[model samples]
Target chain A: MNKSIFYHAGCTVCVSAEHDIVKLVGSENVTIINIGEQKSKISEAENSGVVSVPALVRPNGNVLHINFGAAISDLK
Target chain B: MNKSIFYHAGCTVCVSAEHDIVKLVGSENVTIINIGEQKSKISEAENSGVVSVPALVRPNGNVLHINFGAAISDLK
Candidate 1:
């Protein structure tokens, strides 16, 4: 748990998390990355092993924990 | 109906989707966005309202239909 939490919020994740996760954890604890604009960034996140929206960049920064696409349930 | 589909894959979603969604939908129909690198694009994806990993941008280009992170079932 030494990694920085990086969230790649797309449309669905943003709308849901903005109204859900953001409220649950607050924006302060997380880094929300709007990944719908850049092709390179998106690629980078994937290379980092990111596969979904609302992902939690593990404290160690080794793996990403996805909150599911437009997750109906929370990742935590 | 005019909307373009976008995928913001983090680590979890990527690992799962690479074996799940990617295999189901293949990589051509979807444009995966690795949002773990650039901070700006992450914000952009959020603005687009993308909320999921395997999100389907409606042909109308209004709402994003997320495929859910690490989806067990296919979006189609």
Candidate 2:
């Protein structure tokens, strides 16, 4: 699955949600990118229709925006 | 000493720098505030002349802005 998680550095919600994402998807299966540290990723995230941090991109290329609870359930 | 560490949540540099700050200040002596999560702290940090994240406010009311290396050296 080409799964990626886009997050910003100083977002508390992102930090907290990431723990659960890693647990649910396993660390190796997900590509976690911090947009704050890597500005290039911002374009990629924007292209995927993600305007905010803590977004998840599914293997099917669908962008899940901020609903970490729903994203986790969808991933499961 | 009224020591506080002002940081933004999604800052990778802040994340790395905080580890060093915590080690130097011993967690108990420092108040680590995430400005992104707590907007009120922004004004407090600004009052101390802190314009960016990863700033260290010394007990003397001096703000060390973004100079984590210098801050650590001064703390030690």
Candidate DockQ values, in order, are 0.03, 0.02
DockQ, 0 to 1 scale, candidate 2: 0.02
**DockQ of candidate model 1:** 0.03
Clash count for each candidate, listed in order shown: 49, 7
Q: What does the lDDT come to for candidate 2?
A: 0.56
Q: Candidate 2 falls in which docking quality class?
A: incorrect
Model 2 off-target regions past 4 Å? A67-76, B1-76
| Tens digit per residue, CA lDDT, model 2, B1-76 | 5455545444666776566446434687678887766766667767776666666666655544432222222221
Task: State the lDDT of candidate 1 residue by residue for A1-76, as single tens digits.
Answer: 3324555545664555434434333466555566655444666666666666655554444443434563212222
Screening candidate 2 with a backbone cut-off below 3 angstroms (N, C-alpha, C), the clashing residue pairs are: A9-B9, A9-B10, A9-B11, A10-B9, A10-B10, A10-B11, A11-B10
Please tell me the TM-score of chain B in candidate 2 relative to the true structure's chain B. 0.74
